[model samples]
Target: MSAKVMPDAKGRQVWIAAISKKSGYSEELVASVLEKHGIRPKVTAAVPQRLMVTSLSFTGKKLGATPPSDIDFGPKPMGPGLWAVTSQRNFRGKTSILNIIRWCLTGRQYIADVMTSWFTAVTLRFTLDDREFEVRLSNASEGTGELLKHARGNEFQLASFSNHVEFEAAMSDFFMEELGLQKIENHIEKDGKGIDQPHGWVWLFTAMWVEPRPSALFGVQMPGAMSARMMQMYLGFPWVNTTNEIKAAQSRFRVKAAQSHLVSSGIRATTEGRIASLAAQRADLQAKFADVSPNTARLKLAEASQRFVNADADLRAFVAKKQVAEDDFESAKMAYAEARRSSQAAKESAAAGYVFRAIRPVCCPSCDEVITEEAAESHLRDHTCVVCKTPDRKGDDEEDTERTLLLAENEAKEQLDAQTTRVRLITSQINEARLARAKASEQCATAEAEIADMTTVEENTVRIQILDAQIAELRNLNQAETEAEDGDSKVLAAAEVITKEMYEVEQGRVLKRVSDLTKEYAVTFGIENLQSVSIDGGVRMKLIKNGQPTFFSKCTDGEKARLKVAATLAMLKVSEDEGVGRHPGLLLIDSPGDNAMVSVDYENLVSGISTLSEELKTVQIILSAVSGPVILSHVPKARRIEAVGDDYLW
Candidate 1:
């Protein structure tokens, strides 16, 4: 309604719409997706009323004593306006009482360890709006308690718990429901990254307690944006919780982005390194390939190899022919010898026959008579053998047989001569084939030696092919890595921009109001030569004194005390006046006059608190300090809860 949507459904819708525009997604899809991720705005609605303590009571017992002794502290009555708890000295239980009240209210231990060990039970009674509530603890250390509400002479049980954590959570829930205080969330460091941490009543009570050491401009001194968030929560600024949630999400995104970037960069670097190595190998292979003159080498080797193969084949043929020729020569020699023998035998036979015919001798006849010559001659004329022929018919037959033997021998001699000539020719051809094969072998060897550095062109070509494949794969991987980007960072940035735009003007106005109040209250607390005070949304307070600039930490202890008080009172006053803040209207100041403070400064602080308490009737100011004339004059005797020398405040 006020131009800036309060932290609610509308706020969430606004955030979703803004993110959708940046991310190019539909609003409904964006909302569902973000919801799945647990990314939604926090709601901040201001409560107009405040909580006040009406009474406090507790019991303590001496630990480990021979006889147990119990000491009782009031059912002390406390109401609105300035109430002082004082002692002449330190550690006199003045601060203890305040700590007990805080412990009972938040269910957290703020008292000294000794008190926590000694105290057995505590009870705190407080009021919210027109309703009264009571907290009863059976064991203070364990925080075993029951929360009760009183209405029309009847008591009602609200919650009960048995341990500290449960007690704290119950109390926080009760207060959030009763007082409209929402849970606060902060980003804390875990394992070198920011994580979301939800806080309950313990964190919300930062504005309710003021420590002795003045550190920041507003609410319990904390680190980073926590203090600012505390201030904003108390001041009832619109969208404060949403802003804090967005900032925490941003912190988580930053840590994740950094980690994702490192991982992506490592992948890219490894891929690039592989690509470089493969490229170098490819270049080296290319250079060697060029030097080898592959085309010429391949041609020369092919030619020489073919020539060698052909020549070797021819040599094999020639050797086979020579073997055949040798076999034929041996056969021819044998044939020639047989032919000569045949011729000799035929001639001898012819000569013997002619001699027998010319002599005409007869060895035996039927009667061995002396007329053989005349008979043998007659038989020869008849062509018959002399020894056993009935008639003379052997002459023509013997001549014909001798003539056939002579003719066959002559033919055999001619065939042997031809075979010998053929053998000689084949032997010469074999010699020539051997010479040609040797020449071819020499040429092939020379060609092989020329391209020895390349280890045969085939292996070189394979290496080149492998190098190319690797380079291509690496390049593709590099491209994929480049394309895979972090989308969370962009979403976080968009969220940050949208949240900032939503709350800047409203937060500026709130800070200006607080700064003005701080300057005014600083003067009221008697800060010397103070011209102006400026407080930014960062909770950084700058003081302009005598035309010189300074900050909260730079001031002296006394001045810092004054500044802290001023800031606290300014916030309270602003909340009361605006009717829009969530401060509980309860201020607990512990040792505001410590650290060798100036007496006048202390008096001025007491006097100012008295006047402010009168002006803001709803605020209850509880001051713990050493009893002095200044405290005596300002705080009435009836409201002073004091401990004398060497005594506790109980």
Candidate 2:
């Protein structure tokens, strides 16, 4: 083993300020303990990757037309721009239009049974960066659909499939192909059991799009942890692989430790119960040790002699300890004498000041002037001294103060005397103990000599030996289990270190990018004091206004809407800036006006979307909103689809 331990390159348990302070453990001690148990984390550098979606469109056979009417998204390729599908009227199929596009990109449609019942042979055409592919799903309402795929220049290639499984797989493959997503395995723990499966498109879809909900604070519609994992994947970090591995290892260790605890508990119970039952067995063994018989088979002569000598040595050691204790007692006696002297001095000092005030001078000490008893009485309460006629103020001292001092002195003297007596008694006892210990030593020596002569042990003696061995084995087993428990504890500690370090070095980058970009976007959207946006585990979007995080619930409706838009857009902007975001810059925003936001803020939100579309050359936004002048004015008439008269989006 190397005297100097090196931190693993991938990851290692390093000194954590928070943990060390909370635990009251020194860095060196924590490190030493962790090293002793071989609990070191291995660090691996994450490689960057990026993917994005350019465009998405879909069309199906319409009623009353033998040939299908076209909803042309590709009259021209609108580069990095906004496309709006707006209708002020409720249930006019505006959401349905977005949902249909969503269903093609993802596999979920609005009321899948209902939508498929209404239309069949629906074809989805979308551009992924440069490649244009179309997938058509037919035979819905029967819980079955046929999926066909083709490029703009190529024929519909994949063979038609009528089952939901094949159709779903085809859709998943299409999105995965466009997003450059991998079907990596993820270990999931359910009911204390761990299982692994390839990450599905449902998880990825949460990152690609967000729908408006009256009560929801998060933009994504997935669980907090899942959303966070998806964001990481989109940011070019491999979350499914590393996080899943950590989770799996953690769960495995937890289950193993639990099992170990159960087994160890059983063993402990058995051992304790056995100890009670084996008392008679041990008593029999002790009797054999005391017995002297010709048929008794003795232990090896050399070992027996050594053990006997050790017994005598123990007695000798007791005698030596008693001698040391006796010497300590003598020193204590000397201290007692010194303490008595100190008490006497204290008593003298206690009365000296009082004596001066009590006893008056017949003559003045300063000037050799004789003072009569009448003069002394006058001096007790005089304004001036009689001898010198000098002004002075003196008062009579309290009576019986000397008596109080005397009583204290007496009490102190009694305590000192008692302590001295105790020391004397202890010394006498020590002498008796020394004599007793010497006699024991002599007896032990004689026994040792006799035992050395023995060459055989009795069967009863063998039973005693066997019992002793069994007891020792049980103790060893317990000790081993204790060490194993410690090892498990260290492993958990080290795993925490790995997670902390990974976030510090890797996740911090993504977070920082988001913070900076969200601030920039917030500024563009005219949100002042908004310094940044923070998505913690994708659970909540906190706006960092003037350096303090402002929660979503705390902000105004308009501010909330802007913050949400800023976060979603900023993530893509940051991804583009780093050239490593998996997001293809295609945004599908549902109901930007749902919050009934402030007029200026709502307009700003629309204008900000339009400006971003122009600034970010790689992004394409498909926005759905209610008919409002703020939205209609910002989006050009040609680019915007209005649901006035009979021209509904559906």
Candidate 3:
């Protein structure tokens, strides 16, 4: 790209300066010199245009005065009156050019020299790289030169080129009459070309022009570079300074972003996984607790604990209130139970006592009278006479009745005594008869037993005598036959028959004695009347009755008494026979004596009893009588129990 220079209406000289280290000045150093001279400069590197002066600096040297070696210095107005003095003085060859351009752009003497110089009437072209670009100077006069020389003689420096330049007549006339610099539009261009297309190149510069003094130019004054540096510091870029605040902010931002991303993603995944896994775990826990729920268990345990606490509180309250004593409830219950049992037992015992009292008969002690249980109880309560303690006349008959009962009791006792006496008498007689029968039976039995073993030869003495008679007859026949050997055999036989007859007669007499003894045994002992007698292997005999016997079987209750008397009598007889007898000897007959002859055959029984007592000679008869005829006829000495009434026997 290339740039072209243009003249302003003020006839101000403008140029381009390639600022580098080789030119012994930087763009920043060039712009600083222009700023110090009160020249506002525009700066550009790739393109040229108006720019603000952000900063400036200078090298402490002067420019050379030789041709071809002179540094390029010019006015480059970036704004209405702001200009930059740019130079391309080769600092490598002549570093002093840096100070020379510094003085020309900013020195007060150089401002006067340009205003008076002959070339001041025309513009100057001060291109550093191209010769084709130039300016024409005009309208210089000797008077202007003398004024400029006088202005330079003073030590006081002008604050700006406009101080002198504004005095130059020609430049002032051109600015006012021909060029009208103040009216010229400030248009930006590129490549020394008009901005007719999007890609035109225009040489951009700034001018600070005044009459009779040199005009100043600045090339591309850049305000953006400084702003960029300020922004770098303000924004705190990490590349410039690691400790920059922006770095801390960036570090904090990155860390927060990473943490947020991790948290968000992790929370999302966890929520999803938890939803599914918790469902499965819930099912598994339910199955595991199928038999029992943990919640239920906890609830039950809590309930139980609560109940226990409640019970403990209740018990404590009860004890405090003295409603219950420690360990006393059990004892109280036991005592209650025992009391109940004892009460029941006492009731039973009382019931049994009532039963016993009902059955038991008691005689009143005061009256000697029997009373029923109820009457006895009343009598005991009243403590009155049991017979007739009442003074009421109604009891007179009761007194008579009691007297009659007393008489009856005395009569009953007398009867009992007489009956006892009679029983003893009958018992003695029966015992004598039983003993006689037993003796005769025993003797018969022995004889029968002895006869049972006898042989016919021992028993038939007649037969033995008959045999001896036969044998004797034969012998007699033989003796007779020997004496009359032939005289008559018949007569000898007759003599043997007579001898046998005499022997048979003697055996018949001995057999008759055995028949008489057997008949005597049967008649005396009554064995002939016995139906049967069973003899045991031990020789004990029992006599059986005949088909029509006189005695009764299994006696009546009344008869048992009589039979008991008979049995007692038999026992007495046996005792007497053994010489160990204790017979009372007094016979007392009671009620049976009145009807003793109901069977006439019973007379034989009575006689037999009397005969036995008489034969023993130790027995006495005492008979009690209610009727005189009965006992008086049987017993000569019979006693009657007397009553207190009119009846003698009563």
The segments of candidate 3 whose C-alpha lies over 4 angstroms from its true place after superposition are 1-543, 548-553, 556-563, 581-589, 593-599, 620-630, 638-650
Give model 2 RMSD, 1 decimal: 28.9
| lDDT of every model, 2 decimals | 0.76, 0.59, 0.31
Ordered by TM-score, highest first, the candidates read 1, 2, 3
What digit string (tens of lDDT, one per residue) describes model 3 on residues 134-166?
222222222121111112334222121233343
In terms of TM-score, the best-performing candidate is 1
Report the C-alpha lDDT of model 2 over 100-163, residue by residue, as the tens digit: 6666656665544534645544556565665555555655433244444446555666545566
CA lDDT for candidate 1 = 0.76
- Count clashing residue pairs per candidate: 5, 17, 63
- The whole-model C-alpha lDDT of candidate 2 against the native structure comes to 0.59
TM-scores, one per candidate:
0.64, 0.54, 0.15
Q: Name the best candidate (by lDDT).
A: 1
Clashing pairs in 1: 382-392, 383-392, 383-393, 384-392, 384-393
Ranking by lDDT: 1, 2, 3
